[model samples]
Target chain A: MSNKKIGCGCLGCSIPLLTFIILLVIILPLSIFGVMNGAFGSKGIPAPKVELPAEVIFHIGVFPVTNTIITSWITVALLILMALLVTRKPKLIPGRLQSAVEAIIEWMYNFCKDVAGEVKGRKFFPVVTTIFLFVLINALLNLVPGYGTWPITNYAGHEVILLRGANTDINTAAALAVIAFIFIEFWGFKFNGLGYLKKFFTVERAFKGWGKVFHGKLSGFGDVLFGAIDTIVGLLELLLEFVRLLSFTFRLFGNMTGGEILILILFFLLGFAGFGFVQVGYIFEMLVGVVQALIFAGLTLVFATMASEHHGEEEH
Target chain B: MNIFDKLAELGFSWPTLVAQIVNFIVLLVMLYFFAYKPVMKMLDQRAQKIKDSLDETQKIKDQAAVAEQDFKKRLEVASKEGQEVIARAMRSGEEARQRAQQEAKVEAQAVVEKARQEIQHERDEAIGELRQEFADLTIVAAEKVITKSLNKNDHQKLIEQVLAESTTLNKKA
Candidate 1:
C-alpha cells in the first residue's frame, strides 16, 4: 500500500533542470557573442538546423543504417538494461525502481482494460504498451544535449548529422502505424472472422431483404438506392482506413520534427533572450510527447476493440 | 517538384521501413518474454500472497472468537452450578438444624420424665416410712392407756377395727 516510485539513483531529478538552464541561459549566449566577435576565430556561430531526413551513419552491404535507427537502438538498449536492473531480483515487496516500473505498466494495463474490454484488452495490451513506450522514449530523447547535434562524415564524404529522435523520422512513424494497422486488422479477422469485412464492404447488406422490397413492389426502388449509396459509403470508409495510416505517420512525425525545428530556430535567433520561450516550448514538447503517445495507443486500442466486436454487438 | 517527389527525396525507403519494423518486433518479443511476463507474474504472486495471508488472519480471528464464546459459556455454567451447590448446602444445613433441635427437645423431655419418676419413687418410699412410724406411735399410745393384756382373737379384731378407724380418720383429715 505504501509503494512509491523512486527515480533512478544515478541522476538526481534536478539534473535536467540544471542542464536546460546552463545550456540555454549561459552557453548559448556565450557562444553567440564569442562567435560573432571572432573569439574562436575563422568560423562563425554554427546555426542549429533540422535535417528532414535522418542521415545514414554507416552501411552494411547495400543497406544504409541511419542515425535515427541508431538512436532507436540506443533507446532499446537503455530500456532493456533498465528492465534487467529492475527485474534482476523480483520480490513480493517491490523496491523503488521495480515499483516505478510496475506503476507505469499497471497504469497502461488498466487503461487498456478500460478502453478495450478485459478479454480483448489483454490480447492487444503488449503491442499497445510497447508502442506507447517506444514513441514516448523516442520523443523525449530529442531533449538530450548531444542528440541530433552530432556530426559525422558519411561514405559519400559529406557531413551528415548523427543521432535524431526516432519518432521524428517519417519512416519510423510509418512503420509503427503500419504495424498497428496490421494488428487492428488481424484482431478484426480473429474475432469476427469473415464478418469483419462487412464493415468495409456493404455489398451483402445491399442485397439483404431484397425479396421483401420486390414483394412490396414499386417501393423496391428506395431500398435499391439506399443500398447502393450505403455500399459506396462503405467503399469510402475502406479508403479512409488507408488514410488513417498516413495520419498516424504524419501526426507523430510532424509534432516531433516540428518541435525540433522550433527549438533550433528559437535558440538560433533569440539566443539568451529566448530562454523563457524555449523553456515553454520544451514543456509543451514534453506534454505533446506524452499526449501523442497516449493518442496513438488509445487509437490502436479503440480500433482493436472495434474490430473485434460485431456490428450490432452493443449499443454505442 | 510535387509532394510525392519531395517525399521520395526524403529517403522513404521500403527497406528502411522493413528494417524498422523488424527492429520493433525484436524489441516487442524481447520485452514481452524477459520483462513483461516476469514482472506481471511476480506482481500476481505478491497479490495472491497478500490475499492468502489476509484470509488466514481472518480464519484465526474467527476461531479465537469462537473459543472466547465457548469460554464465556463455560464460565456462566460453572457459576450457575456453584450457586446451585450453595443453595443445596443451605437447604441441607436448614434440615440438619431442624433435626438437631427436635432431637434435643426429645432428649430433654426424656430426662425430665426420668427425673420425675425418680422423685415419685423417693416420695413413695418416704411416705411409706412415715405411715409405718405413725402406726407404731398409735400402738404404743394404746398400750399405755389400757395397762392390760388381751386374748389372741379379741386382740386381732380390736387392732383391725382400730386400723380401719385410723384410715378413715386419715382420709377425713
Candidate 2:
C-alpha cells in the first residue's frame, strides 16, 4: 500500500469560513434590523436592574424561607425521587436510568480516587458527590423559564421573582462552605490527633528545639531563626483556612448570581435580539454550572485529603 | 453602621443561614443513603458478577480443554494397545504354525523309518526260505542226474553253487 497523507485541505476550511462570512454579512444584519423594527417598533428596550437578594417566598416559624430555598427543596426532592427510581429494583443487568446513574457514580468515584487516595476517597465520596449533585441541579434550575420570571408577592410595590437558584443565595453557599470546612477540620483531628493543632500553632516547637540545642540536635542560631519563621508561617496558614472558607462561599455565590444577572441584563437590552443572546448565555451558564460543581466537589475532596495527611510527607 | 448590619443588608440572616445549614444537612443525608450508597453498591455487585462470570467461563473452557487432552491420550493408548495385540497374535500364530509343521515332519519320518525296517525284515525272511528250497531242489536234481548214486559232497557243492548264482542275479536286478 502507498503511504498517503489523509487530511482536510484548504477547501474544507474555506467552505465553513465562506458560509460564516455570508451569514455575518447578510443574514445577521438583516435579522438584527428586523428584530429591532418589527419587535420593538417605536418603544425601545428598557434598562434592567439586577436583584441581588433572594425573594422571600414564605415564613417558616421565625425563619423567612426564600424562593431559592424552595427551589433547592424541590431540586432535592426530584433528586431523591430519581435516586429511588434508579435504585428501586436494581438488577445485575441495568436499565437506562440505572446505567446512567451508575455511570455518574463510577465517574465520581474515579474522580475522587484521583483527587484523594483510594481509602480516604471512599470516605469523602458521598459528601463530595452530594455537593456536586446539589450545586449542579440547583444551578440548572436557574435556566427554567418560570424560575425567576414568575411573580409571587409584591416587594416595594413591584412584583418579585418567585424562584431563584439556590447557590445564588449567600446563606446557602456559606452553609455549604461551612459544612465542608467542618468536615475538613474533623478529618484533620481524626487523622492527626493533637498534632492537627500544631499545623496552626507551631511556635511551641521553637521552644522545644531551643531545649534540644542543649542536647546537640538543633544546636545552631540559624535553626532557631528558621524555627521562628516557620512558626509565623504556620500562623499564616491558619489564617488561610478562613480564607478558604470565604473563597468557597463567594466563588459559588458570585458565579451563579452573576449568570442570573447577566441573563436578566441581556433580556433587557435589544428586547427580541437579546433572546438569542440569552440562549447563548444560558448554554455558557450551564457549562459554568457543571464546571463549578466539579471544582467545588474536587476541591473539597482535595482539602479533606490534605487535612488528613502529615504536612511533611511527599504526596504519593 | 456595624459590619453585621451591612452583611444583613446583603440578605445575610442568621436564622436563614441556620435553616440553610439544616437544609444542606438533610440533603446530604438523604443523598448519601438514597443515591450514593445504593449506586456504589450496585456498581460493585455488577462488577463482581461480571468477574465471576468471566472466571466461570474460563474455568469451564479449561476443563473442556483438559477433557479433550485426556480423550486424545486415551485414544492414542487404545490404538497403541490394539496394534500391540495384533502384533502379538501374529507372532504367536507364526510360532504355532512352525511348531505344527516340525511335529508333522518328525512323525512322518519316524513312521517311514519303522515301515522300512519291517519291510527289510520280511524280505530277509523270504530270501532265507527261498535259499533253503533252492538248496534242496539242487540236491534232488544232482541225485537224479547222477542216477548211479554220486557222493553227498557233490550234492552239497551243487547247492552252494546255486545259492551263489541266485545272490549274484539278485544283485544285478
Candidate 3:
C-alpha cells in the first residue's frame, strides 16, 4: 500500500487510528449505555435543586456569613493579588502579565472616557472598573470545577456548598446598585449644585404662571397647564431614578442565577452526554459574564454622565 | 404581606449589603492606587520617550545633511583654488619664456653692433695704411723722374703739399 493511503504502514498511524476506533466505536457507546443503565457504581443523576437564597455557613457576632460573601471576599483577594503581582515592579517595557493588566485597565478607562467626558469620566473610572472586575471575576470563577461541588458543614450541621457566585446573591447586586445610585446623585449635585434638584422638583414655572394670573392675564392659564405637565414629567423622572436601583439589582441577580441553573440542569439532563455538550453552556456563560460586566459598567457611566449635566442646557 | 417581608424573602440583609459595599469601596481604592495610576504614568512616560527619541533622530539627520553640504562646498572651493594655482603657474611660465627670448634677442643685437663697430675701426686702420703706402710709392716715382732737377728738401715739400691736397680731395669725394 502507498504511504498516502489511509494506513501509513507505521506504528504511529496505526496507534492513533486504533485509539480513535476504540474511543468512538467502543468506549463512547459503552459509556453512554452504562450511564443510561445506571452501571459502574452509578446512581442516576439527581434532580437539580434551584436555591434562591445563598446558604449561611456561619455567623460572626450575629452577622450571617453566607457562601456568596466568602466568594466575594475571594474575588476581592484574587483581584488585589493580581494587582500586586503585576504592579510590584512595573517596567517601562512591559512583560506579559503587566501588559494584560494594563490592557484591561486602559480599555476600561477609555470606555469610561467615551461614555462620559474627560473630567467626569476620570472621576467615574474607579467605581466603574471596580464593579466590572468584581462582577466579572465572580461570574467566571463560579464556573471553576470545585465551586458548586465542595461541600462543607455549616454551624447548623447542615451541608452546603462552600463557594457560590457573589452576583447571584441579591444583596451584593443591591449593594452595587446602591453605590452606583449614590455616586450618580452625588455627581449631579456636585456639577450642577442645588440646580440638580430642579430636574425633579420644577415649581418655578408654576409660581410664575400663578403670579401672571394674579395680575389678571387670562392667557396665563396656558402657562399653568404647561407647567403642570412639566411638574408631572419631573416627578416621573424622579421616580425612575429610584426605580433604577431595583432594575440594576434584579438584572444582575437574575442573569447570574439563571446561567448557573442552566449549566447545572444541562449536566443533570445529559449525564454522560454532558461531558462534551455542556461546554457550550460554559462558553455561553463566559460570554454572558463579559457582556453583563460591560452592561453594568457602561450603564453606570452613562447615568453618571447624564446626572452631571444641566437639565435645560443643550448638550455640546 | 408587606414589601419589607417580600424583600426579606429575597435575602436582602442589611449586614451583607453593608459588607459588600465596604468590600467594593476597598477594592476601588486599592485598584486606583495600584493599577490605574502606575499604568497611566507608564504609558505617558513611554509616549514622551518615543517623541524625544524621534526628535533626536531628526536633529542628527539634519546635522548630517549640513555636514555633507559643507564637505561638497569645501571640495568645490578646493578644486577651484587648485585650478587657479595651475593657471598661475602656466601664466608665470609663459612670461619667463617670453622674458628669456627678449633678453636673448637684445644680447645678440649688442654682439652684432659691437662686431660692426670693431670691423669699422679695422677697416679705417687698413685704409689709412694703404693710403700711406700709395703716397710713399708716388713720392718715390717723382723723385726718380727729377733726380737732379731739384734739391731733396724741395721735393719732399712739394710731395707733402700734393699729398695734403689729394687727402682733401679724397675726403671731398
Candidate 4:
C-alpha cells in the first residue's frame, strides 16, 4: 500500500519485481566471480547450463538437440495425467490437491465471465483452461531430471544429452500463438456471422466524407481534387486491415523469442565462469512463460469481448 | 514431404476441412458432457441440498418449540386446578364449623330457659306456704277477741276466709 516502494498494487507489477529480485539474487553474485564460495552451486562447473522440460524435448525436430527437450515432453505428459486425476471421480469433500485445482478452475471461470461476458465466457473457457494447463505443465517439467532422453554425440564422442522448455524454441511459441490467433478470428466469425469481415471496412467510411465534401460546400474543381486525396486516405485505411494480423502474430512471437534468446545469451556470456548468472536467465525465462501465457489468454478474452459486442444499428 | 506438401499447397483439400470440422464438433461435445455438464450439475445440486437441509432443521426446531409450549401450558393448568381444590376445601370446612357453633349456642339457651322455669316454680311454692301460715295466725287472733260474741255473723266471716286460703293451697300443689 505504501507509495514509497515502487510496487503498484496490480498483479502484473509484482511479476517484473519478482524478475528483478530473481536476477539480482542470482546474477549479482556471479558477476563478482568469487563474491561467495564457489564450491557449491554451478560455479565450479565449466558451464552453468540446466535442463528444459520433457514435452518440448520430444517435440524437438531441430539440430543440436539437448536433454532440455526431454524435460519438456515429460512436462506435457504430466500435465495430461494431472488433468485426468483432477477430473476423475471428484468428491464432495475434496482432497487437498483437488481443492487447489478446483479453486484455480473456478477463478478462471469467473475471470472469463467477467472479461468476456456470459456468452463469450462459455465460448472461451475451454481454450483458456487448456492454455493455463499447457503453460503450467511446461513450467513443472523444468524441475524433472533427464526429462525425455535423446542420444547426442558430444565433442568427445561418447553419447550424452538434453532437456528444455518447449516454448524456449520459437516453433512452439509460434505454434501456440498461431493457434490462439486463428481461434480468436475463428470465434469472432462464429459469433458475428459474415459481419466479422466488416472489421476491415471500419476505416473505409472516410471515403464517404470525401464524397460529401465535393457534393456540398466543396463543389469547386479544387475541392473535388481535395476530395480525391481524402478518398486515397480511406484506401490506405483499407490497407491497414491486413496489418492487424501481422501485429497480432509477431507481437507474441517477438516477446517469447526475445525472452528465450535473452536466457541463452546470458548463459553464453557467463558459461561456468559466471555460473549463477545463468540462473538469472532461467528465472527471467520462467517469468516470461507466465507473462506470455497471461497475455495470450488476456488477448483472447479481450478480442472475444470486442467481437461479441452488438455491431449494427439498434432497432427501436 | 515436398510432393505431399506441394499437392496440398497447390489445391484445397476437402477431406482435411471435413476432418477438422468433425474434430472440433467432437471436441465440443466430448468436453461438454465429460466436464462442463457435471461441474454445473454438481454446483446446483450442492446449493439445493443446503437449502433443503436448512428448511428441515427449521421445521424440527419449530416442532420442538411448540411441544415445549404445550408442556408448559399443561403444567400451569394442573397447578391452577390444585389451588382451586384446596381453596374450596377450606371454604367448606369454615362453613361446617360456623354451623356447629350456632347450633350449640341455641341448645345452651334452651337449657338455661328450662332451669329458670324450675327455679321460678320452687320459689312460688315456698312463697305460697308462708302466706298460708300467716292466714292461720290471723284466724287464732280472731277467735280470742270475739269468744263471747261468737254469733252467726262472725262464724260466717271466718268460714269464707278459710275457703279462700284452701283454694290458694290447691293451686300451689
Judging by lDDT against the true structure, name the best candidate: 3
Query: Any runs in candidate 3 off by more than 4 Å, and if so which?
Result: A1-6, A9-45, A312-316, B86-173
Question: On residues B16-54, what C-alpha lDDT tens digit does candidate 4 reach at each position?
Answer: 223223333443344455555555455556668889989
Q: Quote model 3's TM-score.
A: 0.78
lDDT of 4: 0.58
Badly placed stretches (over 4 Å) of model 2 are: A1-30, A34-47, A154-158, A209-220, A274-276, A312-316, B81-173
| Model 2 lDDT tens row, A31-70 | 5775667435414534555666777766767667788788
Q: Decide which is better by lDDT, 2 or 4.
A: 2
Worst 10 residues of 4 chain B by lDDT: B10-19
Best by DockQ: 3
Model 1 Cα lDDT, one tens digit per residue, A233-279 = 88997887788898988898888888888887666665554547778
Cα lDDT tens digits, model 4, A125-231, are 87776565555555545433432233455544554545545444333443445556567767868877777665544433445555666577454545456556655
Identify the candidate with maximal TM-score: 3
On TM-score, who's better, 2 or 3? 3
User: Model 1, range B1-173, lDDT digits (tens) per residue?
Assistant: 87656775765667678888987898888778767888878877888999999999999999999999999999999999999999999999999999999999999999999999999999778877777887787779678645677777877887888889788856754
For the predicted complex of model 1, DockQ is 0.40
Residue A67, model 3: Cα distance from true site in angstroms: 0.9
In the predicted model 2, the residue pairs found to clash are none
Summarize candidate 2's per-residue lDDT along B82-103 as a digit string, tens digits. 9999999999999999999999
> Chain B, candidate 1: TM?
0.61
